[model samples]
Target: MSWRRALKDTARSGIAVEKKRLEPLIAVRGAAGLAIVIALSLWLFGPAAAASSAFGAFQAAIATFQRSWRPRPELAIASGTSLAVSTFLGYLTISKEPLFLALLVVWAFAAGMSWAAGPTIGLIASSNVAIMLVTVTLPTSVAQAAGHAAMMIVGGLVQAALIVLFPVRRWGAHRDALADALAAEADYARRLRHDPVASFDPQPLMEARNAAAVTPRQARRRPAELHGARGIAERIRPVLASLADPAMGVPAEGPARDRVRELLASAAALLDAAAHAIRHGEPVSTPPAALATFRTPDTGSILTGAPYRAMTRLNTLLQDVVETAGGAPQESALQGGAPKGRGELRDQPQPTRTRPRTAPHHPPRRRPTFLALIPKALKAMRSELHRGSPITRHATRVSAVAATGYILGTWLPLGHGYWAPLTSVMVMRPDFSQTYSRAVARLAGTVIGVAVATGVVQAATPGTLQSGTLAVASAALMYLLMRTGQFATQACIAAYVVFLLGMGGEEWTQTVPERVLLTLMGGFLAMLAYAVYPAWETPRLRTRLADWLAAQGPYAAAVFGSYADPSASNAPDVRGALLTARTARAAWHAAVARATAEPVRHRGLSRTAADDAEDALAQLGRVAMLLEAHLPERGATPVPPAARFADALRESTHKGAKAIRERRVPTWDAVREALDAWETEDTDKVLRNTATLVLDTLTELSEALDTAVPPMTLDGTAPEKPDGPRNPKDSATR
Candidate 1:
């Protein structure tokens, strides 16, 4: 390649890598806070005092940014309180060796259990352990320790102040999430218009939904608007999927085809408009007259076919979309107006309903006081803890390793033995994959950081000002690359540690080898702890997959049941079932990804089987979406076979779930009988064709599930084939 072309390619790759890093603004805020705190300490105190205070500020700053997504006040309070308690404990035990070792064990266990609450809280707990380890080793008086703790709190407060002064824009993350969902829906519609049988991936939409779910509700401009938009997006997916199926109805031509295309284009445009409004924090207007020409096509004419019928259904959904976008209650839109009987179809079409001319006044909501918030927060934390949870197991492992590491550190001929336990706490995670990966990264990063620190220290010893500057720079670089992956984060953290220690008047050359060796010992202990009693995703794969399969039964039943009784309200129930199934499926996919990253020997499901199962589930979701789309429109004659097919599907799915749970082979006799009955029944041609597709997809899903696991008895013991258990290599190939 030409030099210019190669250079351009290299630059593009670098930009991509940087983009994977955590938000740069967060890093800048952390660095700025640390800089201010360090500068103040240096100005007010001598070099030695400044170094001590800087240590406290650095720890507090790290804790503040550790969980940046939380509300500003909460972040500040949590970080400050956690650091103070940890620092005080460290100081208290400085003169008591046995107590210090005992507390280290207890603290490690507590930090690990904190993971049950969530990743953010767990990070805070782990960081506190690190702070305590570092602080206890420092030679300082009681008053000095107290003062240092206060400085750390000040550093956290500075970060909180910056958050309030320069807040993220209203509806920033929420708007983006909502817009992503809408855009994905619009793209799906566009694809269906061109390729009726095209396969579309639902992962993007699923991810967008997850993103929206996590967004802080208080940050949104209109919380209700987001809810309404998400509802519309979910309803639109199945409709587009059904329309894309060639078996749905007769193909339209000439003016009929053009009209159908026009409707699809209109649906896409409406979604685009809704997304645009969300992005700009404005109101969404109703679609123009061209998009509202659903009733223009005569239902009694020869041109009335599957395309026309599909377009008619599309019109109803679009009306709901427009009404929802205009701030009409989602309940009213979702119910699709009053149900229309066949007799009502003969009359002239009424104008579509829009939002009311005047809004109803409502009293303002009362915000909760701090006193009330305390109980709620406690209740939430309590709910997160349970027996046999990942958190509990992790806590047990972490505490054991920490206690062992501490004892070993004391006995080993190494200075600053606290580094052993500190490294163990840093490397351990709730999951095996994360813990192993972190251990590796921590070891490698420490080696590189030590080498670099040695060179810098030999070249020139930094003064108080120089150390402070280096600390700020390293802190920024560490956080900036933290989110990229474990390796980048560990590397930055290692470098940050070097500068941070220098500020404490430590000679880098002496500290470097000791730090590296102690880190290695801790990392090894963490890995061993996990290996002895792993919380591996592979072992949980079966349960997760079974949950997803089981959820599909209720979801399919709800969708099909809606068609049997159009006048009855089941929309909410159906939506709930669909959401549950989606969540389970997402969880299963995540588990598979984690399993892939783990060792081959530890994996339960082979890569090939996992991939096949994932594909089958995706196809199953699409089929379910198609069935939902083909639900009888208001006033349309109910197809008797539709209910029968739905019942069979529900039964088959339940049976499949039972098989998975019981660890036995799934029997397809009932499903096959349903298919036979479906073929014999006197059903509408369209409904029969759709039923065929559903049965075929279910059969495929069952076969995929069966292949995904080994043949096992009712007691869940795998029985080897006559040739004995298949080789691991063969399982992967199969």
Candidate 2:
């Protein structure tokens, strides 16, 4: 990618408007909170103070709308408190230019480092620096500063109180996440009837896991419908794949395969219905025909060996889903005929049979609460303190840009010196793509906003009440269109800032040119900073791949190690490895997305080769998931050679990751020999069939990652090959 192309792409992306769902109720609530704070401050302190206090409510609302799993009230309170602290400290140094400039850089740097915690924290923290600039000028004495800061906290408290008093879809995010995971499984089931060797994305499951974490206070108040449903969904995905795949369970074409297809269809319907129930908090309305298929013994008679076991397990897991949805205890949702002699269920026909009666025993997964995350956040930020880390590089870049913007704004004859630093702080992101893209967006929006606000101010010459009303309206519009891409939101925010400044008695002539010109200079400074010193994702591609490989190996070994000694299988270890692998996979995908938009070239890996390697790794994870679905019951006889095969795989992959970092082609010779040993020694058909597929997938992974490429591919598209994820999928068919 060239600089010209990059600039054009960034501009196109920055101006693009996205479709977003509007929440009229939440918007109204936030606006109401802002209105109350603005009204009180105007009556007691004056319009200038009112304009400053409005940010507390304004920022609180935006924080609540962030894509975080934490409760809205918590987000509101934290945002308000942080803003108050920034305001209080800024007031202390407002009279001294040198001290205030030092404070601004340090605050901007800390905000930049907060990205390591998550985007939500980083965004709120960054906005605080901008807000601090506005509030610092409002207070004259130290006592007045304290009172002004307290009003900010009060604004936050007002919003939080409103939320607690009138809750709307309290568990909405968690509910949607769990429902999406179940729905994804249902969609996967439908797809498998036609393509049994299909690949299922694990993103939904990972999101559900993230949503499941709660503090102790939250756990006690959590809805009954949310508990334990995610675990059942996790178990269902592997079972669906194991039953449908021909190599693992049934024949490619036969009466058994036909029965498998019907079972898959029924499972899809039932799962969809369960997802609806969970999402809406209602009773599960299952189809009688689908229930009848599971009840009829004919399907079981057709399915034998591994297929029969899959059928039995799927039936039990479905029953668990029914009992958990809407917190129903096996009412007609999924309860019916007697369960087969699956010895695990104490009673053949019991109305109260819930997850504990049949669901597999997996270790409990706990997500850390907002309070518990403090230490982890500290640790994460500490790790990024090294100069090479992107977060550190970004913090440094933004800090320099902020100080430079302040000096330029002060020296230039623009009376509102803070607008320049404010624009720079708002536009600068950690990566090249986002930083450049947002700079374009903020700059464009500022020009349009200043023009509109100037025309309105000149025509109306509005008083405090009128200006405050327009500011409130702009805020409501901003909240409503928050998801319509940053460009749309930036326009509303810009107008809102201008209206607030009008309430503070600023004329249109003085504010318009200054707002537009300062904004332009600030955005330019941020863009220039990123161009000079960038932390390009292209250089880190190999490191991300190595991390994924290192995590992927242990996950496969944990699942395979279970078959070697069923009684020794530790559910917690397997779950931990799965979570680690998912995180690593997500990191690589994010890195790829960032690297693609960059102008830098990949050191050794080409675009096409990188895609191939990513596909191969996804295939390997899919195979492991299938094996996990059919893990043997505890106390079952051990397959000793399976252990050796697992050990060989773990050791070989560890070496492969090390080779990848060294830019060398990896070898899977040990894994091949272990598979050969397993084929000769183990008569277990399940082990025999899957062992070949695993080895083939591993070999495909190594081949895809190699840097050396043929001059032309099958389709003659540069050095890119026509072969994709299907190579391993095709091998599984054998």
Off by over 4 Å in 2: 327-372, 708-726
By lDDT, the best candidate is 2
Question: How many steric overlaps are in each model, in order?
Answer: 0, 0
What TM value does model 1 have? 0.78
What would the per-residue lDDT of candidate 1 be over residues 1-734, giving only the tens digit for each residue?
23344334423432233346256786787678778877886676544455555555555555555533335445655676677678777788868878887887888877887776567677878878876787655536887777767666776677677766766554456577768777777887787677655566556566555544332334333445554456556667777766545555535345545545666677788788777767666677545543444444342342344444455456565555555455343333333332332443435243333322232122212334334544654555566567656777788888888888878887888787878888998878887657766677777777866676567767778865776687678778876776665655666667766776787677776577888888989988988887687766776776777788778767876776776676777777787888888888878878877665554343345566656656655656665677676555466556555566677777777777777655554555655566577688676655565445555555555555556555666667763322212221121112
Per-residue lDDT of 144 in model 1: 74
Q: Give residue 254's lDDT in candidate 2 (0 to 100).
A: 90
Q: List, residue by residue over 1-734, the lDDT tens digit for candidate 2.
A: 88899899998898889876678888888888999989998999887778778989899889999999888898898898899999999999979999999999999999999999899999999999988877898777988888878888988888898889878788888999999999999999999999998888889999999888876667677777787788888888988999999878688899989989999999999889889998998988887788777877666457766666677778878888877785354455445542454334333232223453234243334657667878988888898999899999999988999999999989998788888899889888999999888988898877777777778888898999999999999899888888887787888888898898889787777778888889889999999988898999998888898889888988888888888888975667788889899999999999999998998877767888788888878877888887888777777778888899889989988988886776666667888888778877746877766767777776677677655334433345443222223377786776
Candidate closest to the true structure, highest TM-score: 2
Candidate 1, pairs of clashing residues: none
- lDDT of all predictions, in order shown? 0.64, 0.82
For model 2 the local lDDT of residue 503 reads: 90
